[model samples]
Target: MMRNQTSSTSQTIRFTLIAFGLGVGLTTLVIGGADDATPIGTKWWPSEFGPADERGAANRITPKKVLEARDLIQDGKIYQLGRLYEHGMPIPGKRHFSLTIPGLPTGLPTGNNQMVSNDELVSGEIGQVGTQFDGLGHVGCRVNGEDIFYNGFKLSEFGNPYGLEKLGVENVGVFLTRGILLDVAAIRKADRLPNGYVIKPAELQACLDTADLEIRTGDMVLLRTGHGKLWMEDNDTYGEGEPGLGLAAARFLTDRKVALIGADTWAIEAVPHESDELSYPVHQWNLTRHGVYHLENLDLEELAADKVYEFAFMFSPLRLRGATGSPGNPIAVR
Candidate 1:
């Protein structure tokens, strides 16, 4: 565990230096480009929010939008969209998670009351673990020898070893918006989508048609691929690959100007992706290009069972200064 953390730290430092230099050859490629000719800077920089905006699509959540979302709550039933963080939960890549009590009684019997207390010692990546929230800092595209994030925030200008000087998770404020769930599994007539199945725009349209719904601006969209069924019961399989959206489907949502996209799967985009050459391109398209956020490893079983397709979705990322992401239980109120 220490070794993994050490390696991650070193990689962070290395990447920081490389980004700061702006001329270093090393960079994480942004695959599945629109064309070989167009530069990423010209295509997606100076976001609609402007050059100085760090809030991204989240800026669309206005008082009117909040009232609009508030109107969605009819039943007053709340659904927890996040999964429990445990020792055996399915974690992606080399990330780690563990929780332990420091002692039988962390605090000795104090005062005359003979009171004792227990405290948990949590060790691992807190921000990017189970039920994670991806901030603007989470993903970036290296364009023309420079690492650029949302709103054209150049990593060379903001990258730091300790933490990002900009685009950190703390910059993302509260998200209270109309939330829609597209149960692609039910649309496909399957309990669980087969691994590596790519959800297309047609399927998304079909789901919306059935629900008599439309993706609106500043809405939070959740896709239930049913891959979450394997979460802890089959960790190995859950981590192997997933059934999720293709680039076109992602573009379909971004076209509607959604504030965020979430999924029952760990990664919202299909694993063993639509293109062998691009890895998690949907992530790049949404986070980097559109300044949208992502919520992952959601528990949508109750919502599916109750047939709650639209509701008031709300979540606030932890104010972890300079952190890349956050972990929290987002809720849906109907």
Candidate 2:
């Protein structure tokens, strides 16, 4: 029995020594490979939040932080911002600025001298077209794997009900912070990034390096692939084509602790990888899982040429109660 115990003790000591040696070797390799001047936190991929054990999940930028970032941009200390709107730019859809109200009064007086004027205030439906904000309630995962509106809020919620009175647009209020634009197209030296191409982590890092910028806490990062231009030219191809960030890049951004993410494309992430696709995983990962906001269909051509890495961001969503999203007109000022 004494000899057996001694043998077990020897095995334990040997195992401990092996583990210690392996750990030391790994540490040396990592330290040696990293750039000496790289910030401690920058050397390795940073956690979305400060630490795992802290309250809340990863990549959560508080509202207060956003406000502080915004103030800096407004002071003209930062420059290079994107223009959200391009005049006469056609939005790819069946209805860009069309109005369709159900049950219009039939047999209205039709005469050459007929006049339709609003002499008194009456309320029904208003602005149903043009640029708009997409409120949080605009989209959601299926409760049982089926897409359904929350509380039966009609599609009209995309417009009307302006402000936070109904949908808490007030919660979003005015966002002031640093804005970073990643010109992915320039990195690849392509006039436009092809559709269906999922951007990888290495590619994203390369693009950032080319731009000579690093993401700071509470930054609004906008990724431009020249997809918006293609989208404007051909909606069908743009909607179904191969452009956008991949899951890995999304994870990296969330891990980097960005406050909001925007892209010049439709869906932020590459279409789901599965043949039996369910939900947009990026949306799930960022919005539902990580509490990160997404901005889509932004016009970023001008911003890319400006070579701006930072700016003041501002946006307000239409206040619609019981809605999934608000068609917001978001803008960035340098």
Q: Go through the candidates in order and give each one's C-alpha lDDT.
A: 0.81, 0.51
Candidate 2 Cα deviation (angstroms), residue 198: 0.3
What are the per-residue Cα lDDT tens digits for candidate 2 across 1-334?
0000011111223323342342312121122233421211012212233322111221234676666655656445322233333333444343343324333433354679763332322222111222333334444333222332222222343334443223233345445566778888888898887766677667778877886878876677888888777645775666664477755577778778776788877667664332112235455445544445666777787767777656667655554454434465667676
Candidate 1 clash pair list? 75-334, 76-334
Error of 2 at 80 (Å): 12
Residue-pair clashes per candidate, as listed? 2, 30
- How high is each candidate's TM-score? 0.88, 0.60
What is model 1's C-alpha RMSD?
7.4
Candidate 1 Cα deviation (angstroms), residue 281: 0.9
Model 1 spans with C-alpha error above 4 angstroms: 1-42
What's the lDDT for residue 276 in model 1?
A: 48
